[model samples]
Target: MTKGYIHIYTGDGKGKTTAAIGLAIRAVGAGKKVCILQFMKSLAYSEQKILQSIPGITLITLGKPYFIAKEGMLTDEQRKTWGNHIRIYPAGHPPKDYREMTLKGIEQAIDAVSKNYDMVILDEYNMARWYDLATEEETEKILKARRPEVELIFTGRNAPKEILDAADLITEMKKIRHYYDKGVPVRTGIEN
Candidate 1:
């Protein structure tokens, strides 16, 4: 029996990528091929290290380390905090080589689907579209072109309406409350 493709995970809360990663792990454990294209994120986290060790699973990172803040609208403190969070690329700038990397990652994911991978996870992809790094039409084309037998998971907040309408399954993580509102910072191994 062929598995249906297309899942969208979105909302103002968290756990989207975490859920997708869990699915990827399960797919790899079942001896099925799995691939994760991590968009708008750098490869510096512990999850990346752990997931890369899994057999029959591929991980591709397409973003340089940088905070995705609103342009020209950050306070000094916010700027400082974001500066700490941003990953400094080898070229000392983000968006320098990110476009090519993202495009390549997309192509690689498509190729993996064509090669009969059981699942593909596109992590933080919604943020890419939200930030205007990738267009909604382009994402739609990619999803529409996916092979029937390959399942796909998209993780991120604020997913586009078109994507939600096209998805077979959609999970929204609404943020009722968050510790960040109380001035809590992200913890390593837990938040990272």
Candidate 2:
């Protein structure tokens, strides 16, 4: 292709990452190289097992093993149930180590954009910025480094205004309803 544009998949609903993955698959099918950098996520997701083996695709996950929630985002009962599997922190004070790890991941993304990758997906990047794991200025680095032929996709909820403005296309998945609210857990290969 001669030119590629930026795309953002945001909002509280699901399918943001799914859309990005679909695009990656399409790109690969067309003989294009793809790199997916998942921020604030670990390697436990089932998709990673297959994505890692896909030719012409590079998958990198940057996150701790445990989930993280901003203080007050989770109910007391929820916290109790999660126990040591989740970490809750006060607003504006996310874990320093996590933030540092993401910053390095941002650098890797920037480098990937500079390389020959035809498409780059920054999964959960919106949440990373929302939770202060990454800053808009750091995001700017990847934007600035993007080649004209490199497509960039950012996925996750609560995309900041700056990100929305910078995107060539934006798709917000508004949740009309979800089974999770009805006490369903995230099923593997679907919501995980």
Candidate 3:
């Protein structure tokens, strides 16, 4: 209907990626083409397997699962936990490869959109921009150039104002409270 559109999920809270994945699942159920590109997250959760089981849905994970911490932002325990999440590839260091793969994934997603996909999810893409792995300018350009017939969704914290302005629908997950703040670690099937 109306050649599809754009949906943005942002703000400081959980459920951004979960919401996007829910939409992806819905689109697939309705027999629509769907693709999800998750940046900064490696495939380690049950959702990866479940998503793979869905027909007409494709998922691409870009980058190693290293934690994004500013200097002195995390304690040693947090650093260790993050370290355990790091993903290493067989071909030496993976940061460069992650960048290249991400770019390629974006290009491929654009192509899929142009080819008449129903929905595309750029999961945690804002984090990529926030971390300087992807530029806001480039993301803006891509959004501007997206096919009118494609419905796109972007999920992550700190989405730029420009993106919010351009989006047809925006959902912000404001953090009221979370278990993590109560010393609860992210668990599989819940926060992964």
Candidate 4:
């Protein structure tokens, strides 16, 4: 029997989701079943196409068509890049649709673990906890539900202390250098 570990990819940097996707690809290549649930994002990136075409990988995104941004805070580049899906708001409240989507995603996490998937990746789930869309306690409950053989992964920035404490492995992608800070737009296949 295989022993699965709980891992977290987090921090104020890039590549958290990318790292999870890499892990998913590795898992699939090794003949393991994988379930990838993306939270708070709806952009159709190039990888989505590849992941969909790949066998043994199930990918689902729980988010509105629009992206969330703090009102009056979007840079010119941000507005230009995400012009189609900008949901700028004055308050701190996340959109109701995103909340609903995330709640459903949480349920799906429980279901995925119960079904004995080899690996379950909850991408950007820490954002849900950060925005109060889901509580740390709720996330903890899902972690508890995972079977001993179910590999669980959480990815995002601003992960709660409780979540970090619960993880068997945690990798923080610290942003020491980033081109995004240099006014370069997101590359088509690299950062999109």
- Considering every candidate listed, which one attains the maximal lDDT? 2
Maximum-TM-score candidate:
2
Write the residue-wise lDDT of candidate 2 on 25-123 in tens digits: 999999999999999889889889999999999999999998889988888899998999988888878898898999899999999999899999999
Q: Candidates' lDDT values, in order? A: 0.78, 0.92, 0.77, 0.85
Q: Which regions of candidate 2 fall more than 4 Å away from where they truly are? A: none
How many Å off is the CA of 128 in candidate 2?
0.3
lDDT of candidate 1 over 118-170, digit per residue (tens): 88888998877666566666787677667888888888998887778779999
Error of 1 at 82 (Å): 2.0
Error of 1 at 69 (Å): 2.9
- Residue 54, candidate 4: how far off, in angstroms? 1.0
List the candidate numbers ranked by lDDT, top first: 2, 4, 1, 3
What RMSD, rounded to one decimal, does every model reach?
3.8, 1.1, 4.2, 2.4
Give the Å error, residue 151, model 2.
0.3
Worst lDDT window (10 residues) for model 4? Answer: 87-96
Q: How badly does each model clash, as a count of residue pairs?
A: 1, 0, 0, 0
Query: Alpha-carbon error at 46 in model 3, in Å?
Result: 1.7
Window of ten residues with lowest summed lDDT in model 2: 87-96
